[model samples]
Target: MTQRSTADRAVGGLGPWLPIVLGMLTIFGPISVDIYLPSLPALRDDLAVTPALAQLTLTACLVGLALGQLLVGPLSDRFGRRRPLLVGLGVYVVAAVLCSVSISIEMLIVARVVQGVAGATGMVIAQASGRDRLDGPRLTRYYANIAVVVGSAALVGPLLGGQLAAFMDWRGIFLVLAGIGTAIWLACLTGFSESLPHDRRRAGESSILHDMRSLARDRAFVTPVLVIGLLNGAVIGYVSGASFLLQGAYGLTPQQYSYVIAAGAVTFVLGGIVAGQVGARRSPRALLPVGIGLAIAGATATLVIGVLDVGLAALIAAILAVTSGTALTVPSATTIALARRPDIAGSAAAVVGVTRYALGAAAAPLVGLGGGLSAVPLAIVMLVCTLGALGAWLAIPRAGEGASGD
Candidate 1:
C-alpha cells in the first residue's frame, strides 16, 4: 500500500462537519467527570461512603478512561474508527443509565468505571479520526480546535451540573448524561463516516504491539506524551480537590463554586485561542517552554498561598494560571507527538490519551490523602507535576526538530 500525507488525506473526501461532530464526541470524558462534580458531597452523604471512597469514584473513572484508550486505540487501527466508537458510545449510554440508578457507593463506582471506559472511546477516536485525516500544521490547528471544545465543556458542564444539583439531584446528572450519550450515538450513526480506508488498517495483533514498541523507542514521541500527562495531572489534581477546598474551606455554595470554576475555564479557553495563533506562527518547542514556565510559576505560587491560608481570590488566580498554561501546552504537545508517526495515528493517539488519564487518575486521590480540608496538598501535587513536565521537556533531544512537520 502507498503512504499518504495528511494533506492528501484532507482531499480524500472528509466532510466539513466531521470536526464539529468529533469535537462533540471528544468531550464525553469531560462531561462524565465535570458534570457531576458539584454533587460529590451529596453523593458521599447519600451513598454513606467515606470521603476517600467518594473521590475513588472519580479515580475509577479516570482509570477506566486510561485503560480503555490503551485497548481501543489499537483495536480501531485493526478494525476501524467508526465501529469501535459506536460500540463505546453504546456502552456509555448503558453505563450512564446504570449510574443514574446506582443504589450504593460500590455500585456507583463500578458504574462510573464502565462509564469512563465507554467514554474513552469518544476521546481516543475523535483524536484518531483527526489524525487519520489531517497532519502537519493542519493537524495542530485541529487539536487546538479540540482544546477549545474541551475548554468550553469545562466551563459549561460544571455550571449546568451545579444548577441541576440545586434543583434536581445527583442522579439527575447521570440521567442527563445518558440522554447526551444516546444523542451522540444517533449522530454517529447518521453523520459520521469512516476516516481510515481499509487499505490502511494494520494486519494483526502483533502489529499493535509492534506499533507500541516503535513509539516507545522514539524519544520524540515519549517526551511529549510524558509532558502532556504531567501537565494534565497538574490540572486534574486541582479539579479533584477543588470541591472540598472551595465548599468546605471557603464556605462557598455549589452555585458560587461553579462560577469560580467557570472563571478559570474562561482562562483555559483563552489559552487555547492564544496557542492556536502562536502555533500557526511558531513551532511546538517554542510554545512548550512558555507554557511550562507559566505552569511552574502558577503552581509554586499556589503552594505558597495555600500554606499561608490566604484568601480564595489568590487560590482562584493561581488555578487559573495553571489551567491557562495547560490549554497552551496540551494541544501543542499532542500535535507534536502524533505528527511523529502519522501511519499509526490511532495507536499514537491512544498512548497519549492513556498516559494523560493515567497520570490524572493517580493525582486525583492524592488530593484527598490529607482529608481535603485544605488546598495545600493539591497545590504541592500540582507543583510537583509541573516541575516533572518541565524536566521532560528539557530532556527532549533537539526538541525543535520534533516540532517540525518534516
Candidate 2:
C-alpha cells in the first residue's frame, strides 16, 4: 500500500466538503456587514441618534474585523483552526443577541464590534485552511470557489435584509442574524475537521512578528497582497458610495439600487468562475495583468460616465464591469500570497486581511469627501484604486524572473 502524505490524508478527511465549509466560514464577515444595511435608517430613528452616529455602528464592526484578524492570525497558527473558529462563532451568536437587545446607540455599537471580531476568525482561518490541504491548481480552484460562495452571500444578504425589514423592526434583523450564526455554528461543529495537524504546525513554529517581517521582505508575496488589497479597497469604495450616486444624485429608489447591487454580485461570481479555470493553467504572475486590464478599462469607463453625466444604464454597466474585474483577481492574487508560505499560512493570510480591511475602511470614507452628491467621488476612487493595483502588478518580476510563489 502507498503511504499517503499528511496533506492527502487531511484532504481525505475533509472530503468534498472543504470548500463549502470554508466558504460558509468566510461568509460571516461580509454577511454581518451587509445584512444590517437596510435597517440603518430605522436603527437611527429608534435610538434617536444622528445618522452619523448610527453609521458608527458600521464603523465599529469594520474596525473589529480588522483588529480581530490581526489578533487571531498567530493564534490560529499556534492553536489550529477548529478551536479558534468554534470559539469565535459562539461569541458571534452572543454578540448578535447583544445587538438585538441594546437600548442605545452606544450599546449597539459595542455589540457590533464584538460581532465583527468574532466573525473575523471565520474569514482568516478559511483562507489558511485552504493552504493546509492543497496547493497549485487545486488550491487556486478552492479559493475561487470560496469567492463564488461569498459573492452569492453578498447577493442574498441585502435581499434577505430587505424582506426582513418589511416584516419586522430593526432589532429583529439581529435576531435573524443570531439564528443564522447558530445554524452555521452547529454545522461546523458536526462537519468541520482540523486540517492543520499538530505535527505539521509544530514544524513551522516561529514568532508571529518574525514570520510577518519575513513575508514583508518577499517581493513575490508583497505583489499580490498589494494587488488584491487595492482592488478590494476600490470595490468597497464603490459599494459605500453607490447608494449616494444612484439615489441621492440619480434619483433611483432603494429597491432599484438593490437591483444594481444584485447585478454586480452576479457578474462578480462569473468573473471568479472564469478566473479560477484560467488560473489552473497560468501562474499567478501571468494572470495578474488580465485582471488588472479589465479593472483599468472599467475604471476609465466609470470616469467617463461620471464626467459626462452618462445615464443610469451606462453607469451601471461600467460599475458592473469593475466589480467583475476585481473578482477575477481574488483567486490568483490569494494563491500567490499564501501558496509558498505554508509554514506561516495563518500569518500570511492575516497580512492580506490587515491590508484589505485597512484600505477598505479608508476607501469608504473617501466616498463622502465629495459630499456624496456626484458619481465623481466614486469614480475617482475606483480609478485611483485600479491604478494602484496596476502599479503593484508592474512591480512583480516578469515570467522569466524568479519568484517561486508565482
Candidate 3:
C-alpha cells in the first residue's frame, strides 16, 4: 500500500459535501459585492443618489472587507478559525437583511459596509483553515476549489441581479442573499471541523503588532503579498469601471454587461485551476514572472484598444486576458506568502487580505481619475500597478531562508 501523506488524507477526508460547504462560505463576500452591481443604476434612481455616490456603496463594502479581514486574520490565529467564521456569518446574515430594507443610499452604504465586514470573516477564516491543514500544491488545490466556486458566483451574480432587478426589485437580491447566507451558516455548523489544533498555537506575545513585525522581516513573504495586492487591484479597477466602459463606450445593456463581466470572471477560475497545476510542478517564484508578463501584455492591449477605439470585441478580449492573468498569479502568490509561517497563518492571511483590498480600494478611484472613461488613463493605471507588482517581486531576495510555517 502506498503511504498516505497528511495532504492526501486531508484531501481525501474532504469528501463530497465538504467542498460545497467550503465553497459557499468562501464565496459569500464576492457574491455580496457583485450581486449589487447589476442594481447600481436602479439603486441610483430609487435612492436618489448620483452615480458617484452609488459607487461609494461599493467603496464602503471594499473598505469593510479590508477592515474585517484585518481583525479576523489575527483573531483566527488566537482562537481557531471556526468560531470567528461562525460569528462572522451571523453578522453577515443580519447585514444582508438590513441592506434589503435600507431606505436610502446612505443606509445602503452602511449596510454594505457591515456585510463586507462580516463577509470578510468568512474569507480570512476559510483561508486560515486551508493553511492550517495543507501546504504547497495541496494548499493550492484547496484555494483553487475556493476560487472556482466564488468566482463562478461572481460570474453569475451580476446576471442574476439584473434579472431580479428587472422582475422583482433591487431589494429582493439582498433578501435572497440573506437567505443563502443563513443556509450556508447552518450547513457549516454541522459539516466543518477545526483544523488548527491547540498544540500548534504559539504561547507568547501573539499580538497584532508582533505578527506584523514578524511578517515584515520576511522578504519571501512580503514579495508575494505585494504581487497578490497589485494583481487584485487590477481586477478591482476593471470591476469598478466596467459598467461605464461596457454600457457607455460599447453601448451594452445591463443584461449584456452582465454576460460580458461573467465571461471575464469565469476565466479567473480557469486561471486559478491552471495556477494549481503549475504550483505542483514548480516554486511560485518560477511562475510569478509568467503571470505578471501576461498581465502586462493584457493591460497594454487594453490600453491600445481603449485609445484606438477598437470596439467592443477588442475591449472584451483585453478584459478577459488581464483577468485570466490575474487569476493565475493571485493564488500562487498567496500560497507563497502563507507557505512559511504556519503558526501565524491567520496573521499572514490577514496582512495579505488587507493589502489585497486596500489596493483594490485605491484602484477604484484611480480607475476613475480621467473623470471619464478613456483608454490611456485606465491603461496607465493598470500598467503602473502591474509594473509595481513585478518590481516588488524582483526586489525581494529569493534565496534567503527556509520556508516558515503558514
Candidate with top lDDT is 1
Per-residue C-alpha lDDT of model 3 across residues 294-330, encoded as one tens digit per residue: 8888898988887888877877787787788888878
Which of candidates 1 and 3 reaches a greater lDDT?
1
RMSD of each: 3.4, 2.7, 3.4
Pairs that collide in candidate 2 are none
| True lDDT of residue 286, candidate 1 | 72
Q: How does model 3 score by TM-score? A: 0.89
Candidate 1 C-alpha lDDT tens digits along 86-134: 9999999999999889999889999999999999999988998887777
Clash-forming residue pairs, model 3: 340-404, 340-405, 341-404, 341-405, 341-406, 342-405, 342-406
Give the Å error, residue 206, model 1. Answer: 2.3
Winner by TM-score = 2
What's model 2's TM-score? 0.93
- Residue range with the least summed lDDT across 10 consecutive positions in model 1: 1-10
Q: Tens digit of lDDT per residue, candidate 2, span 161-225?
A: 88889999988999998998898899889778887877656344477777778888888788889
Residue-pair clashes, model 2: 0
Can you give the TM-score per candidate against the true fold? 0.88, 0.93, 0.89
RMSD of 1: 3.4
